[model samples]
Target: MAATITNTVIDLSHHNTKPDFAKAAADGLQGVIHKATQGQSGVDPTYAPRRPKAEAAGLLWGAYHFGTGSDGVKQAEHFLKTVGPDHASMLLVLDLEGNPTGPSMTLEEARAFVTHVRAVTGRWPGLYSGHYVKELLHAQKDPVLGQCWFWLAQYGPTPVVPPAWAKWTFWQYTDGAIGPGPHEVPGIGACDRDKFNGDAAKLTTFWKAGGV
Candidate 1:
């Protein structure tokens, strides 16, 4: 069987928007995908346009929250509310770029926050952030998210997985795309065939098991 290439969140800001890009690239895809947020806590009006394009091309969809000045948990709550969690393929994502406004929380606190949100939502929200951030947490072996599948954002040839993070289900490789919009992970072409790791049945089973 061919390995599935499922890069969950594609942030279509200044980068991915072009003439007929989203509408074009929606062909030959599988599993749930998300539109990444940009500017002032992820409330861009472009989501409406991007989503229909993907849906037209046959892709299950959702939205991802790029974190800002607020606490991680609070940011997550806002994202969940903003996107709502009952779509065809609903998966909330927490994008942790850095602590620009508020004081950075300790590793313990960050992990705890992730765990708390997962418990509350009953879904395994994804983590999208830099390699350095993962490395910092790796040193401490963050207990809160040892098993979470990472959507790593590294614009390069090969993705470097932090030792602490063992499994990497998705890797966002670049801000460029070939035929259409900016691909969430450009190097996904490096993989054979693309599909989500778990089908709806598997996702539902995981949810019931409280694995998120």
Candidate 2:
């Protein structure tokens, strides 16, 4: 059987703050859709390998903003400028987790930002958050998000994606991962590995089509 593209996302955020990044990425899986923060300074050194490795493996590569309360368009521009245009991410994720805690946005405002990201990037931008954020969006009522896909991070053994949210292309099932890295970070333990539903090509199209 051909190898399945059970894509993982590596975040550069401190493991405690964002525990899934290293564990998921270094799982030595087919493709990875890692994220990097923008608008402050430069790209993250840890997440640096995510894009190159994906490209090298002919695997799906994607990136997203940490959603630092910046306007979606500005964030998109910052990502493009930093990562360069050649690195075409299958999907651009707007991590909608931490924003609402501070001088961030409400669910309604966050949705608008997501739309703006899609408009500016010319690709489907996805939403990355836990169950609460999904609930906040009331994903059922406001379903059609152009071509965007959802990169759900509701950690568990089963696929906890809300049915009303439609098919989720990427499901992060666990935080236990182990591997080498761009920095000397501890791995997240062992990964479950059987959860991915799509292949690389599917992932690519899914990403380009906004993860729909």
Candidate 2 at 164: error in angstroms? 5.3
Candidate 1 off by > 4 Å? 1-10, 18-26, 31-42, 99-113, 177-212
RMSD of 1: 6.0
Expressed as tens digits, the lDDT of each residue in 95-158 for candidate 1 is 6666566544444444544675577765566666666467566655555665555666666655
Task: Look at candidate 1 and tell me the lDDT of residue 124.
Answer: 64
Q: What TM-score against the true fold does each predicted structure earn?
A: 0.65, 0.65
lDDT of 1: 0.51
Query: How well does candidate 2 score on lDDT at residue 148?
Result: 52
Tally clashes: model 2.
10
Q: Which candidate has the highest TM-score of all? A: 1
Kindly list the per-residue Cα lDDT of model 2 for residues 52-121, writing each as its tens digit. 6446644456666776554555655666566565544355676666654445534555566566665655
Score candidate 2 by TM-score against the native: 0.65
Cα error of candidate 1 at position 91, Å:
2.9
